[model samples]
Target: MVGKRQSRREAVSEHKRELILDAARQIFAEEGLDGASLRAIAVRAGYTPAALYFHFESKEAMYAEVLHASLESLGSAVDQAVSRTKTPQQKLKAAALSFFQFYAANPRDLDLGFYLFRGGMKPAGLGHDRDVRLNAALEAALRPIAEAAIALGAPQERANLLMVDCFAHAAGLLLLLHTGRIRMFGASAPDLMEAYVDERIAQLVQE
Candidate 1:
C-alpha cells in the first residue's frame, strides 16, 4: 500500500512538472529567455511560484532543459536524414540539409537554441556543468553530419573543420534570412545553403 501511494505521488509530480515545462517552453519562445520570468511561467502553468520551486530551482536550469530537448530533436533529424541516404555524398548532403532545414522551418527553435533574443552577451547562468552538457548536446547533433563528411574521403581533421565552416556560414545565413536581411540581396536561404553544400562537397572531393 505504501509503494502504491508512492508511485501515484510520483506520477502526479511528473505530470505537474511537465505542465510547468510546457508553460516555460511556450513563454521562452514568445518572450525569449531574458524576458521570460519565473512568475510568468508559473502563472501560465496554473501553479504558484512556491509550487514551481519544488520542480525547478531556477530559470536557467529550466532554460537548459528546454534547449536540451531542442538539440535532441536536431540530432534526430540528422540521423534520419543520414539513414535515408546510401552514398557518403548523399549522406553528407542529406545531413547538412536536414540540420539547416530544422532551424529554417522552426525559427522559434533557433531563437530558443541560440539566445538570439538576448541583448548584449549576458551569460545564461546555467553554470559550468550545464553549459558543458548543452555544448555536448549540440556537438552530438552535428556528429553524424561530420561523420558523413569524413566518409567522403576527407581526413577526420579536415572533416571536423569543414563541418564547422559549413555550419558557421549556414548559421549566419539563417539568421540573416530569419531577420529578413537575406532577401535584400534577393537570394533564397535554401538555395544559398544548397549551393554551399555543393561547393563544400566539391572542394572536399578535390582536396
Candidate 2:
C-alpha cells in the first residue's frame, strides 16, 4: 500500500510539472520571455506561486525547461517531414521546407526555440543538462539535411556547411516575414520559401 501511494504521488508530481510547462509555453509564446511573469504562469497553470516554486525554483529554470521541450518537438517534426521523401534530394528539400513551414506557421515556437531567454542566463545543474539536450536536439533536426547532402555526392564537410547555409537562407526569409518586411517588399512568405527550396536543391544537386 505504501509503494502504491508513493507511485501515485510521483505520478501526480509529474503531471503537475507538465501542467506548469504547458502553461509556461503558452504564456511565453503570447508574451515573450521578458514580458512573461511567474505569477501569470502560475495562474494559468492553476497552481499557487508557492507550488510552482517547488517544481522550478526560478523563471529562468521554467523557461529552460520549456525551450528544451519545444526543441525536442521541433526535431521530431523535422525528422518526420524528412522521412516522407525517398530520394536524397527530396529528403534535403523536404527537410528544409518542413523546417521553414514549422517555424512560419508557429511564430511562437520560432521565438521560444530560437530567440527568447537563451542568452546570459546561465542555468546551473539541470539547466546545463537542458542546454546540452537542446544542442543535441538542434543537431538532430539538421542532420537529415546534411546526410542527404552527403548522399548526393558532396563531401561531408561541405555538405554540413551547405546545410547551415540553407538554414540561414530560410531563417532570414522567415525573419523578414515575421517582422513584416517581406510584405513591405510585396513578396509572399510561402512563395519565397518554395523558391528558396528549389534553388537550394538545384545548388546542392549541381555541386
1-207: candidate 1 lDDT, tens digit per residue? 999999999999999999999999999998888889999999999999889889998998899889889999999998998898898888888888898999999897888777633676664446788889988988887887689788888888988987888779879889988999997999999999999999888887787
Q: What is candidate 1's CA lDDT for residue 179?
A: 98
Mark the regions of model 1 whose C-alpha exceeds 4 Å error after superposition: 121-125
After TM-score superposition, what is the CA distance of residue 61 in candidate 1 from its true location, in Å? 0.5
> For residues 9-70, could you state the per-residue lDDT of candidate 2 as single tens digits?
99999999999999998898887676789999999999998899889988878988887777
**Could you tell me which residue pairs clash in candidate 1?**
none
- Global Cα lDDT for candidate 2: 0.82
* TM-score between candidate 2 and the true structure: 0.87
Cα displacement (angstroms), candidate 2, residue 62, comes to 1.2
The collision pairs in model 2 are: none
